[model samples]
Target: MNIEFTLNGSVQKVTITSVERALDVLARQCGIKSLSGTCFEGQCGNCLVLFDGKPVYSCLMPAFMLRDHRIETTEYFTKTREYSLLYSELTKEGRSLCSSCHSGIMLMGMVLVRSAPTPTRDEIFRTLSNVHCDSISPDDFADAVLKTIQHLTTARKIP
Candidate 1:
């Protein structure tokens, strides 16, 4: 099957088998390495991609499933102003110390913060629980969430 969609802001058309996973097509064929594939069982959030603006596990979504939808991966996040601010805040606070799980957790945190600016502590815990970054302490995650909220709040007030 031939699938055409905007990948990281570029219009791409690729011929892939119906059974092939979207992660494979994006990483191997389309040269999108940020969509990391680990467990391939959907348990790990490493293969996450924003499908039509909502995050989805690309490893579990077939290539044909994305035939007509927009797919935004981590690469796209790097180019966005919102994500850039989030990244800067995360790094400045030393939240990037968890090198192994930094990317996935950071991405998840950024999305959650944007969608729910004032998420409760429990909500923040729930969101971070899905991540496998054992190196990150719960307190550290909470601190990051709070810091992100502060950043967003200040940014909103500036303009």
Candidate 2:
């Protein structure tokens, strides 16, 4: 079947089989390079993408589900101010994530901070818990997310 969707601000049409997943279609058919995964089970968030501005595990999403939807890969997101802000806060904590997890974490952070500029620590942790990674301590990750939220709050208050 042929499906059309907006990918990284461009409309694209790709053919997909019933068994094909969005992760594969994005990379193989649509030439999206920012998504990759070790697990196709969605346990690892390495295949994360923004589906209509929300982070989703592409590995588990059927290709047909992407029809008429908007998809944003990490590469596209890297150009956004939200990505820069999240990346800066994460780096300020002095820990570096693997490339895959870094993308997932940053995307998740953007969603969290945008949806709730003043999220509680527990809420932040809960949102971040979706990405399975061991590079940073949970408490440390929470701290970084909190800092990102704080930064956004401060910026919004200015002017």
Show the colliding residue pairs in model 2.
none
lDDT, candidates in the order shown: 0.75, 0.81
lDDT of 2 by residue, 1-159 (tens): 999999989999888999999999998988777678778887888899989997789999989999999988777767776678777767774678777687778777777767744778788787788789888767877777777777777887999
Q: For every model shown, what is its TM-score relative to the native structure?
A: 0.82, 0.88
Give lDDT tens digits, candidate 1, residues 44-149.
7787777887778888988888787888776677766667666676566454546545666766776677775488888778777666677667677777667777
Alpha carbon lDDT at 123, candidate 2: 80
- Candidate 1 overall Cα lDDT vs. reference? 0.75
Best by lDDT: 2
What RMSD does each model have against the real structure? 2.4, 1.9
CA lDDT, candidate 1, residue 7: 85
